[model samples]
Target: MAALTGLLFLGAMGTANAADGFQTSVPSAILVDYDTGSILFEKDADKRIAPATLAKVMMADVVFAQLRAGKIALDTPLVVSVNAWRRGGGPSGGAAMFAEVNKPAPVGELLAGALVVSGNDAAITLAEGLGGTESQFAQMMNAQAQAIGMTNSEFHNATGFADAGQVSSARDLATLAAHIIRTFPDYYPIFAKPNIEWNRIKQRNRNVMLDAGIGADGLQVGWLKDVGYHALVSAVQNGQRLVVATLSARSEKERVEETRKLLEWGFQSFRQRQIFAADKEVGRAQVFGGAQSSVGLAARGPVNLLTPRSGGERVSARVVYTGPLRAPVTKGAEVGRLEISRGPVKVLDVPLVTTEDVAVGSLMDRAIDGGLTLMGDSVRDLARRAMAKLHK
Candidate 1:
């Protein structure tokens, strides 16, 4: 709720459990609609837990960002450090790509190993290549997580191996998976690959949603002796895509079965619909000392989301900004945000831009608006203070 502060809210406010009707055995799980960034379902979605190999998705994303920015090419050769080899390779009793020590593994192979096989060696090599060391790379991971709004996650190492402090939530991992799909379509297919061969060792990918007949393309799976199993998976049905993250399952069967159930339920229950057109006015905002008292607002693109196929859900929309904006507003300039929700769950929070320009108003208009704003501010401030006291 702290994230909702400082912005105007024009939607209904209340506290209700998200995805209340559905139940599952996994301790932390989330279902997200890929297109509209909606939370279709969630249970303990934000409770921090060790994600184990699921953290490789974050490591992979960092490398993807670097590749997209032209910082490194797929063909660039990365050295496999002894530290990476001994700790993340075959000797560690963890998943490994088995790259030879002192040999240079190409960036492309490392990406595939990390994503397809969940190879710690491949992940560590990429971390060292991109950030010079695993510890430093963890800092970069934390930075990227914050940039992308994975607020509850923190990374202590690139391999998801560290003190208990290395942690992420199911919601954050799902966000990471969607971020990969949306930002790196070229590399995203690596997750869907069935297997990868390195050092003459071939390992079948653990994420077998494709074989499960659930429309899963690629993602990850993990197990820790005491921490249980976790998976971050995505699936598509009839061209609609959804991401599901399940953490701390009791066994391999539960991890797969529970995730498949959530994905199928989401696909069956929702249909995508365009609620607002790209150029049409979404709402309006007051403009002080301008040619007009208010300016029309529109989204940069069409607003679409997975609405219940049966319809008639209690949906609400909001416009957020600190206004009345003073003078000379330009058309297409961003001024606020539009947030839409169903029941108490957030759906979309998109940018809002001015629909038309408004030039500066006359001196008399400015004076009047200033006086009115002063009075309004005082009244709003008093009300805000009272609300703060109540909150305390």
Candidate 2:
């Protein structure tokens, strides 16, 4: 049985198809489907690079978590610490909210400063207020990164100030952006605010996509002397939301152009096709010890795929399971996987679960089924060996 399952797994390792014709100057980039977590296009997406102000996204995430837990309210006042003042303030020579030292600001205004204007001081102030110190707040940032499965991220500060070990990946940033969008939707609107008034300084948002007439709503942008310009831009069109992350572009204009190209390609190049509805039978699996000889298998939710719009290639699907399955089987138990492919390229794979339970068969029925299972196993072994030889 184990060998048969291995063979089945090998058989299901589907082929790959290239998403060609799209290119970008950004060294690291990724475009993902917000609904399905599908990678439409990527370039060195996992390579860790300085996230610069993009780290504020995670900083905002930590603050949003506190807000959701009721530990702090939007109007909660936080005083600017000396560390926040000296490093992230006007003296730091970076973007700042120009917050006065020892002056208190509301959590809502601080968030606006940090997100809309990329204020390093507001980020540090929020960090210190929440975590007692910037160092401790960095610990919280790392812990949150782990919780959210940002495998290639590390944080040394909330302000995203250049540090020795501070780095993140485009893919990880996309995941973080998606998480923020899904988790704190009530607070997400602040990212789109064009500018915020704090300490009498009016700074416009650095995100150019908002002004480009694209469906872009809210997200973060990052830039550093050595790291160049990076942007995590998301847009919605016709109910479809897509997030694009770019790192190390030559200039702000170049980053914006590259990100826009990726978004346009993603929206214009692919069309979604619904393959299976929730709880709808996709196929059947043979059951050895159940009263019935076979059980229906279905998808837990609607299965959809984004396929090339040209429509020249045919899409195929197969249900792969280790069988004959022994009863009793419970409904909704994951029994197999559904693999969908366009031509030779596998596009989507989802679990195939039993739609109904199967009860144990009678003693005589079990005996008959047991003998048939042995015979079927022998045939499967031969077929597996034949297939292996053909591959060689």
Candidate 3:
């Protein structure tokens, strides 16, 4: 009875903690640090709910990855098959891009259709262009999601505009968006295109945050009856970028406003600090006989530290080397790590290494050192024997 009562009390406490942390405004929501990939906030982020139009982000990922790899060029032409036209076209027949089957469209305009107009036809066209089929393209998307560490995501189809069991979580979407921005920065600008004119058809962007004062750019908006409304929004301000995603919104305007509010709250509440710069010499190590007596150490990139903006919070840094470094090390060899902390909570871990090499001494130096060591050992042995006799 006593143990059961204790368990009940603990369960109640857990529920209270979750209640405080969970954002009830949306069914699922997540906010993250784009620079460091740190999750600042999350609520029911892994419930495996419907992804709505937000699924297009994965499609965008597939297309952009292929584009970056030189597997396909922007002007590459893709033939619109009957399958893509029928399934991917606008709302009446799958939100079709009004693309004609058996007609050729450039991969770039099709991407604009998929991203800007949310045309199902464009998605299927790009998928077929890259994966040879919509189903196969979805497989590629799932594979890419897994590779980028999105554990709670699954792609049932190429376009996330509509389909049952095609689901992802808010946290996963945020993670995916951040990965796209980081991995395919070259093509990320496409997401920010406010309007695209193709075949004399002009479509405007639906993401209001793009024009909002928050400096948001490059993300997708999604909606469907089953999933309500959803969007993955990202913004960069003063060199700091953040990604936020929400699900089950009541309306498009609500999702946009809430996303803006959430982003503002996050940016106002927290700040990213550069704890250490990569490859910047943190310190120096002694060299044996090189032209320089010592070598420098630093990380490869800036070690970013995210902290609350209230100030007075303690942030510490420590470096870990790759053991005792050998001589003749290059100027940019990675050597160690710098661990940053706020009290007991770790904030950042940066690598530390040698900036230059210390060449080993010459043959003459080695010979003299060997002779001195031999003489010293012989003298020590004789002294030990003398001491033993004296003790005896």
Scored by Cα lDDT, where does model 1 land?
Answer: 0.82
Between candidates 1 and 2, name the one with more favorable TM-score: 1
In order, candidate lDDTs are 0.82, 0.83, 0.70
Instruction: State the lDDT of candidate 1 residue by residue for 6-86, as single tens digits.
Output: 333333222123444668789999998898877778889989998788888898888889999999999999999999999
lDDT of 3 by residue, 1-392 (tens): 01000000101101111233434477778777877754556667777877877777898998888888898899999998887877776434555467778899998888878877778888888888888777888899899999987888888876775666677888788878988888888878888888877666677876677888997987887788866888789988788888988888888778887788778877876766565566666666433333333477777677665556554333445555443344566777765555554444333445566766666644543343334433643453354445446757
Residue runs of model 3 more than 4 Å from their true location after superposition: 1-24, 90-94, 161-164, 274-302, 311-392
lDDT of 2 by residue, 318-367 (tens): 88888888899999999898876554445456788999999997675566
Which candidate achieves the best TM-score against the true structure?
A: 1
Q: Tell me how far candidate 1 lies from the true structure as C-alpha RMSD in angstroms.
A: 6.7
Give the distance in Å from residue 344's predicted Cα in candidate 3 to where it truly belongs: 13
List the candidates' TM-scores in order: 0.88, 0.79, 0.69
The number of clashing residue pairs in model 3 is: 20
Minimum summed lDDT over a 10-residue window in model 3 is located at 1-10
Any idea what lDDT model 3 has?
0.70
RMSD of each: 6.7, 6.7, 10.8
Error of 2 at 73 (Å): 1.0
Among these predicted structures, which one has the highest lDDT?
A: 2
